[model samples]
Target: MQLNKQNLTAFAGKLPCPDYDRGHLQTGIVHIGVGGFHRSHQAYYVHQLLKDGTPEWGITGVGLREGDRAMAEVLQAQDGLYTLVNQRPNGTNSSEIIGSIRDYLLAPDNPDAVIQRMAHPKTKIVSLTITEGGYNLNAATEEFDLTNPDVQYEIAHPQEPRTVFGYLAAALRKRKAGGHPAFTVLSCDNIQHNGNVARRMLLAFARHQDPELAGWIEKEVTFPNSMVDRITPVTTPEVSEYLFREFELEDGWPVVCEPFIQWVVEDNFVNGRPPLETVGVQFVPDVSPYEKMKIRLLNAGHSVLGIPGALHGHPTIDACMRDKVFAGFMRAFMDQEVTPILDPVAGIDLEAYKDQLEARFANPNIRDGVGRICSESSAKLPKFLQPTLRENLRRGGEIHRATFILAAWCYYSDQRHNEKNEPLEILDERAAQLHRAAAGTTTDPISFLRQESIFGDLSEQPRFVEAYTEAVRLVYDRGDVRSLMADW
Candidate 1:
């Protein structure tokens, strides 16, 4: 049976299907960037609320880029229904069909339609999962990049908006003009204080277009900070094949993830919000401690293993964890360097959270790729790893393992291949610049650290420079990351 609204009855006996009638569902939320993580995390949470008889929070997904056309095709063909498979550490599988997404619109195809949907009075919340770099903030100034060509175009022609900020500013302007109340802007990205970042970027863009409109948004709108956690990998053809072979369900783009999921959100909204708190969503007064803890530990832990593990030719995170030396290095980096910098997260046991992260990484069934974790290091390291290094430098803490990881990244960027000589696909936006810096490592020794946008004067710090120089020398001279990690 195919996965669609019509086939829910067919999948009922085999897997968990939506129990409510989706036809009567209304759209109260407009979510941008409908990727695997959105489907598995935010969409999944909304699906739970739908199952509990709250039909007002159905989502209308918007895809801004041309790459999102593929997802648009899949979800539209499936009648906004898709299968979500949870791979457990114990080798068991659980699957469910999520039905909260009522419609999808590719913005490049019809930008006006997308804006009008958000301007509608019923759409109370506009959410985003547009990745860390999607906000278009300048790295040094941490302000919206008004110099971007697309942003300039959007500012010149707001009616034909091409970016998220453009569309948001246009829609909010319409809402204010039509005497409609402003909707809450919720950001579910992994960045610390994501809501604040979103608000700043959007306001910068809005002010560039119209100062009066920007003031209205600042006074009326609320960007609720949120921390969303899930281990959803890219949906490969093998995943679709597995769904077909095991459950006889032909899904074009089914999402697969680990069995762990979490969402901690600030309880602040302008218009009415969903009863998400009743569905395992923690609605707290402050989300800073929770966001800080997750980013420093789980996200940084991935980088600690991913950079060296990729150089050592580990295919997946589980493969790295299978090696005792890599596993020990991961734990040591967290306990010695990261844990000390974190503030006390209310009601969370730090040690137990660390244990849970280890178990999640070691789950063989998840097959979370090392390349995926290492792809966008330029953007990720600034947020995830560098903060810990900055804090450690101030307090004089252990920086050996963290410094070595940076060395491993330089070598990885320079070589672009594993020990086995197989090419590692470098996917960062700054790949060319990274390779250029890494090429000068032999002569300068700290050339890679000189990328001021990334390192931000850390190269000039004596302690960091000493540790980095030693680590880079070892990486090149010995040519064995596993042995270096074991000895460290």
Candidate 2:
């Protein structure tokens, strides 16, 4: 049978779907960005409440961008019922039907509906999984871009909002005028200090509309920073086909992810929240230690190898992991460079965490695309890789390997052909500008580094300048990543 709420009992009897009654779920949370990550991670935990026969908190997912239209339709068709496949490297897999999302609002189609859903008293938390660049942060200053065109439009047209920032600020304003309590704003994106970043950007947008409302948000609303981990790839037709052929269940948009998942959140909320600790969530007084560990090791580790992996003509992270040189570079990059900067996380054995991360990256079943990791290199490198670069400079540490990462990305920007001389895709919005900056790499080695927004003061730092110059020279001379690794 096709996946939908109407088939709940019958499907559960035939397949391993949710065992609890579907009618008991009530919308207590409104999650923005109904992407693969949100479904596989946050919604999975909320769905667990139903499986445990305590279905109080269902989710109302809001689609804020153009890419979300198809997702909105799929969930709306299925009554928010979709399959989740947890594939492991050890060749074992399991499937479950997650039933936490009760409704969806494609904001572009119906803006008022999105605002009303968020403004509703029962929607205690508004969570977001929009990617790093979606926050509209200024690349150079790392501050909220108040002058962004969308933000500007929202400032003027408060009632008719466009961006997520606008919708959130407007909805909160409505709740305040109605004398309803403020709801907590939660960020589930992989950005560094995600909660604080959300609070900063949200208030900035709100202040533009009404300064009083912004101040109220600053004082009343709780933005809990969280660290969420799950290797969820974009759902391809292959996944849907697999489900239909294997299980005789045709889920329109099933999420395929690795078996592992983790969420570490701050215990700060204006209204009540789910008992997330019941599902292995670490609710801590401070999320910094945990956040730093994840941002550096996992996110940073991805950046450390992303471009080099792509340049090696590898399609997925598992392929990169299978290459001895790529695998060696990751281990050295993590253990020697990233581990030194990270503080001792509470209850975490850093060594074991590093080993587990390596295993997860090498998981062949997940098939996370290297091209996907290379997509927002401009935004990601600054947040994920540059911190390590900056810290290594501050502490007078070796920067040869980190310097190679920068060079690899610059080279990757100019590469439109594979080793076989066939056309290859460079999947970045900034591809044109980056290729322009990478013009004459051998003759003008520092041109790419001169991008102030990306490299900032690193161009002026003597230590990095010397290391980067050498690294770029070495990669260009050998013309192969394998040789570069061998020399290192």
Best by TM-score: 1
Candidate 2 stretches with Cα past 4 Å from truth are none
Q: Candidate 1, residues 1-488: lDDT per residue as tens digits?
A: 88888778988898898899899989899999998999999999999999888888999999999989999999999999999989998887788989999999999889999999999999999999888878997665566877899999988887878889999999999999999999999999889999999999999999998889999999999999999999987777888888888889999999999999999999999999999988899999999999999998999899999999999999999999999999999999999999988899889999999999999999988999998999889888888888898899999998899899999999999999899999999889899999999999999999999898777788889999999999999999988999999999
Displacement of the residue 321 alpha carbon in candidate 2, Å: 1.3
C-alpha lDDT score of every prediction, in listed order: 0.92, 0.85
Q: Lowest-scoring 10 consecutive residues by lDDT in candidate 1?
A: 137-146
Q: Could you estimate the TM-score for every candidate?
A: 0.98, 0.97
Off by over 4 Å in 1: none
